[model samples]
Target chain A: MNADQLADVVAGVSDPEIDVGLRDLGVLRSVSLTDGRIRVHLTPTRLSCPAVGEIARRVRAALAEAAPGHGIEVVWERGAWQPAAVTAAGRDALRRGGYRVAGTAPRCPYCDSEDVEQAGRFGGAVCKVPYDCRGCGSTFDVIGTAGCNAMLPTPVRGGSR
Target chain B: MPHIPTDSDVYEVFAQSGHGTALSHVGSIVSPRPDAAWHLAKETYGRRDDLVKLWVVRRTDMIVSSAGDRDLLAAKTRMPYRQPGFPTARRRDRSAAPPAVAAPPERRDSGLTERRDDAREPRLTDLWLALADDLFVLGNRLGERIVDYIDLEEALAVGSIGQEALAHAGTILVLCGFDQPAVDARFFDRAQAQWQVSRVVERLTDWPSLVAGGLVIAAAVAVLAERTAEAEPGAEWLSAISAIRDEQLVHLDHWRRWARALAAWPETRTEFARAYAEVTECAGDMFGARPQSQGQGVPAAAPPAGPALAVTLHERLAVLVGDNGGPGSRLPDGPRTRTWGVGGSALADSLSRGRAIRDHYAPGVFS
Candidate 1:
């Protein structure tokens, strides 16, 4: 019905890991509409995160209802997502949701207990890692963004010894 | 043993405000403060007014987690097949462990090659081989010797060491961008090429030999892992190896405890030393034991100083293995009795074969 209201629809897409919306999480970089086509730019907290595809899908679905017959494209650029973009509320929500911002033991999202132990770093899923909450004796998944050793000491393919 | 960080990082001061109330935690704040604790409680739990007590605990204090008064980190995971008196490796289904988080595929071999082009020296391939091969061969031998133990605890320890060794080998393989089967085919399939590993297995077959081997291997790995952690504390390569290293240090402690236990018996200690003397020369080569020349096939390693870690590991391993009151106890055992005959011709052939491995790898080059 209106230009500004139609443009704000994709902002409602929430990050799967954290329950906060894209706009609130500061991942939604910019959204502009032109000639029945909407271009949305989003950024990821981690480059290797697999949730990028899911978030894009949610953006498309959210936009389909408001801007019918309009082509909506969600694009992500590396280095676009900044920690400063995350709102105060988003950070608080993440803490409340049992995820630590800095690399420390996270509180239990379920029991809200700080007595949580990291079970292992090799969390099988790309987005979430495995952690055991000792307080309630329950195991849960949290955002797994710890291992970022991108510049590995590469080996040259040499003949067998 | 539970891991204690070499340095204390932070203190999470909790102002209980009251006795029965909870303690609050925060990031590194070295100052004595009821005020900061007050703010943390207010921000995190919104319960500042309910406190009249305070507990300033060191960060490492929380690091030591306890389960029934025992350090949970030191607790041995009793693997069923690893249980003592188990006769064969075939009966034991090697468990599925936490898989390695390899660096992105594109960057795996390419990074080392690019770095090699700029710096024309062998990268730490020798160290990598030593670590990888030690883990692989030790794990295989340990698994094979599982029947030697009669006690449940000792057996479990043996199994745990072997299993963990295999798991670590996988990560080391991934990090080196080498295939496990390929490595197995290269070293494991052929006995002659296994100069570093065979020295241990060739002379010693009993459980005490396993203990001695376990002692040296675990100690070496622990030292290397600690050094690696210091070098790349927050790196991705460090990430996979670091986690494995933490637990491996526990395995090291477990083997040390076993070694200490075996040392209590004089007969067992003698057997251990007998086994030690056999593999002593090639012990340094445990990291990069291959006697072959480092041709163009080898990639350039940063900080190229022939296997410094190996030398350090060997020296540290000596201190550990020598602690059993056996003062200069590394008594030489006679000509290595082989599956083949112990005749003069056989002995002469074996001596030359062994010398080649020693000469190729170079004994004191690590320093």
Candidate 2:
């Protein structure tokens, strides 16, 4: 398959933790078909990402099934992954799933209170951050993994506050 | 199979300020349940200091753009005022504000008190905690759904969704001011010890949709080694079992680390850990029982006792600095700069003071 098509395939892989696609979530970095073989590179949000092997295996198997005896070489690129905002389209899908996308300020996912604040770096899983809300005065976790914070790419220097 | 449209969830997050400022949104939380959504929002958004509140909802409730539609870029025929194109410098400046009062400094907290008193009334820390919690839960959810794929395109979509969930969650966490201790440290130590799995999904070709599908089964085996051992399954099911095991392992690691850190401090650690565990339970139930209560969906109020880590840290710093008199008084009163010998003194002092105030009223909560 072509690189773009291959990338689409890689992006479709689901994360066991959050149950979303890689492309929409911003995990799969690059997918290339080189020298009669397909290579996929990805960064995990956390250091010891639990789903890496699973993700790779799934990708390989999917490609093989789709191409029928296609030689696929899925490579795990080294880098700490950080979470990224989904494309506008992805956001739409999430909205359909009964979620509210942040418009002005990023809102909390727990109490619907705007009085929420960040809590910890690590969420229960690799791709998330724990937060707390004041209106409800409670804490919860958010999804994150695969970009600057995760260590794969040097995020825009000093981009996030 | 008929195409089932996905639903979007809305997550509300806020930020807290030390000087009594209303919490503001840092990011969002994604979840099917309002209670679980909000709890996750708080943890993800408010892991740092001075947090106050969190909010979350389903994307379906929020009005937004969709994936299939290309209308976002449709050109406006008339009414230039309504269009959101580039604006002249002067117009841009004027549009942003009345153009009378000078822009406030980025880090300045000038009208904090007034803002706190405003109808919005959210603390800075609360906003952050909620965002963080939202992201964490969303990430976990992504893990649950992304595993065991059918084809390349689907796999890519799964990874994309998972990554997006994580990114939003991270934005909330950072903006809210939570600190990550070990960048490379996995969330769960014990889980990691048992399983060595990766979080990146790489789909090359088309497979199937079910977790029991062949592609998913292979992925599961490669990713979830430990869980495979725990589940007695035939070789045919190895892939699927492994996929779940791997995802759980990674997820467990993250939770374990988070729990341990929240519990590492003095008084609040236990409560923090306990509350956090309840909020993001693996089984989505009781910590030790079958009928677990995740604060009934909304975040349970801060345990009667808050985290004592701040208090203990404060007390320890007080004793240490008190004995040494700390840095011989050369530190400046502005934002602390150095982490060197005397530089750390200010941080210690600040921690001590805040802890003292919080603990004075609550006692054992921090003492």
Candidate 3:
């Protein structure tokens, strides 16, 4: 299989917790075929992310099925993964799944109201923070900046805070 | 009347979703007491269906390293040996396996020869060993009293911190060229006098004493780790020391929080103050001046000077207890002259107690 086809296969693997494809989540760092060996690099949302092993396993299994008898190496790159890495598609997928992406002014997922206050800096998972909506009287988790200060609202990219 | 501030501190909450999952920082809450912090954390972060366990630590207790410290975290050279995926990657690419361990610098011989005239001077290896052994002893010491804490949450926190200390000690041992067996031997078989743990760690008698002594020693270790990293640039162990220092900062914060909490209440304040004074009395040598640099010949870096470490510790203690004739008013204004080193009996006793417990449960498994 060509590099593009292999990339497509690997990208199809979704994060088990969020139910979003690795490509959309911007975790699939890169895919390249050099000397007939396919190399795929993944960057985790957090260094201590529990889903990393599962994600890597799924990527490996998918790639192996797509490109039979080919050398597949999945490398985990070490660095901080930012909320800005999330693709627009990833954001939409998360919103549809009742989650809001951080790095933007978080709105209530249920009512889409801007009147939201931080209930907790932490949420159900490491990458999420809980926000309470005044309009809907409901609490929703935002896929916030991993391992960064969740207390402050992350300024939107290329925009004033 | 003493002005007791009513404002609560922010406590960061970490939670484990399942039995085997790693605890992740889920969020934070504002609370006055550790118990109240835990309850607020549960309400805030534990609304989820997956929550299994929780740990609430004061946010201010965290010692965050500055941006300049990032260089210490960065790998100046590629260290494929440390990476878990390196072997598989090497096999897939038909490349050779990287060396399992990097050789530590040969500063010991030079350090000794240069300081031959000054027989009292410790070699760089000796200082490093002292730091590691101290942590090992402190960690096991904390483990012995985990069940003796006032509450289950405090016990759990103490247990977690103890495990962290032990882990940090193990990392330092690896940097000192110890393989797994050597590391195990160092923990289980080292003779008592050979241990270089500070006297403060050996003197922990109760919960208040542990909190006070741990605060002092954790701060000292953080200072020593920073000084060691600064002294030995480009060394293979720099990264390990950096990581240890980072965690040591957290441990320092944890202890500081407990000290402040205990001191805030009128009932516990006196007890904590007495414990702090006792620990501080023997903790003098921990911040002793750097052995006067053996003139010109020593190639090894001098261990961190005592005054610099003492200044920082005094400042932290002053903050914990107000400077206005508060609990720590009796804190020494300058580094004390007395030398500090626990006798081998302290370590021997600790080991015997640990062994007794092990033997009680498993019946000679440790034997």
Candidate 4:
């Protein structure tokens, strides 16, 4: 199968934490095909995401139908997850899930409070930040993981705060 | 979410915006029972009239109070009141008579919290750089301790954390507008005299204390990162901070797991306690620090900035170690605060001694 078609297959794999596929969450950093091997580099929303193994397994499971008998090795890459990596569709998914995405300020996932503030660093895990919604005064976790915070190549411009 | 759909039976409403996207929740509608809920929800939230589908779920089914089981919910609720952003609203309009009503800094539950106004982000950027310096040093120390790993897993985990830390430190250095050589000069080559990291960093005689100490330090940094991210100056660093925080999540988990595993043994508690004592001052200095230090160098006093991180390291350490005392309750009961200064172990030592000396000479230094 062509890389685009194969990518679509792996992209369909759902993120266990958030209800979006790897492609939308932007964790699917790259997918390439060479010499009868399918190489997928996935960025875990967090460094120690417990679902790393599970996500890889699911990617393998999904790829079976599309690229049967191909070598699929999921390599977790360096760019720590960033919200900017999230596609527009992924953002809609987050908003629909009651998580608000405002500029640098973390919007409340539970209350959609635009007036949010940081509650703590370790939001239960590495890829999450504990944020308190000023509107509801309730603290909830926001997905802090995305592609690397470094500015992307100008052409691939998907900048998010 | 009980408590969420309080007045009536809360039915969650999901709507399809168009084709392609899955049905997402628009809003909720309250009704006497489940049947009438969807109809009311449609009328309430479907006013846009573009929805192709809708689904109402009993709010009870969607109640996720977080991954924390019944036990941790209480402690989790008591997170310190410091708002985690390098709040831009404060920076955008600095006039004492702000035309717009800004978000109140500490409205949560009368906790002594850091207000958004006090997080002078540009100044705090400097603090973050200082933090990067501290982390670089600690990461180096942690890297050295990789040899003390109980197993491959421990070594791998600690080694990964150390590497991530150094990388984060590099990012912060870059963010501080430093060139590579300057970063190398400040972080790698020279000693940040003010980085009085809690002596516990050096005192990590065993694995448990090391993990415990790292946990407290990470928590303090996490809080700082959150606050900084909320600020205007911190916009560029948000993604980096978030990514770094993700590593912290791993660090916290590994350390907590390590500490907890050791807790089964008797000596680990003492070790944990020792870590707490050693790191507590460093943690305090790291957050609500006074400008002076154990080093003879003078501290530059900015406007009386609130403790960047209002949470007490002692309390956070207590909870992490399973003492579960609940935020330094057993310690002197008062508003959460510390003498604001650069974070480090030596700073912790200097601060403690400084507090004593300051009180001795000035008598009312605290008062």
DockQ (C-alpha based) per candidate is 0.02, 0.02, 0.03, 0.04
Best by lDDT: 3
**List of chain A TM-scores, every candidate:** 0.63, 0.69, 0.87, 0.78
Q: List, residue by residue over A1-161, the lDDT tens digit for candidate 1.
A: 45467556766767876688787677788877778788887866543345776898888888888778888877664334444566777767776665544234456777878776655333434334456777898776555332321111122122110
User: Which residue segments of model 4 deviate by more than 4 Å?
Assistant: A1-161, B1-122, B192-202, B289-304, B307-367
Q: Candidate 2, which CAPRI tier? A: incorrect
Please report, as a residue range, the 10-residue window in candidate 2 chain B with the lowest summed lDDT.
Answer: B285-294
Model 3 agreement with the true structure over B2-111: per-residue lDDT tens digits:
23233348787899999888988887778878778887878777776668778887766676555567677677887664467754564455335232122222321222
Judged by TM-score relative to the true structure, which candidate is superior, 1 or 2? 1
Tens digits of lDDT, candidate 1, B1-367:
4455444545565555557756555334453454564455445543445545545555666655445546554548876556554444433332232221212123112112211122332235445554555566567666655555555445555665666677666556555655544443333233332223424434334455656666666766666666665654545455455545554655555555556665566767666555556545334444433322222211223355244544655565566546532343352221111121111221222333333454587655422
What lDDT does model 3 reach?
0.62
Error of 1 at A61 (Å): 26
Compare the candidates by TM-score and give the number of the best one: 3
Q: B86-137, model 4: which lDDT tens digit per residue?
A: 2333333333432322111122223222233333422444445545655665
How does residue B279 of candidate 2 score in lDDT? 22
Tens-digit lDDT track of model 2 for B10-36: 555666644577656678766666767
Q: What is the Cα-based lDDT of residue B319 in candidate 3?
A: 48
Indicate the residue-level lDDT of A37 in model 2.
81
lDDT of 3 at A7: 82
Q: Is candidate 2 or 4 superior in DockQ? A: 4
Cα error, candidate 3, residue B227 (Å): 0.8
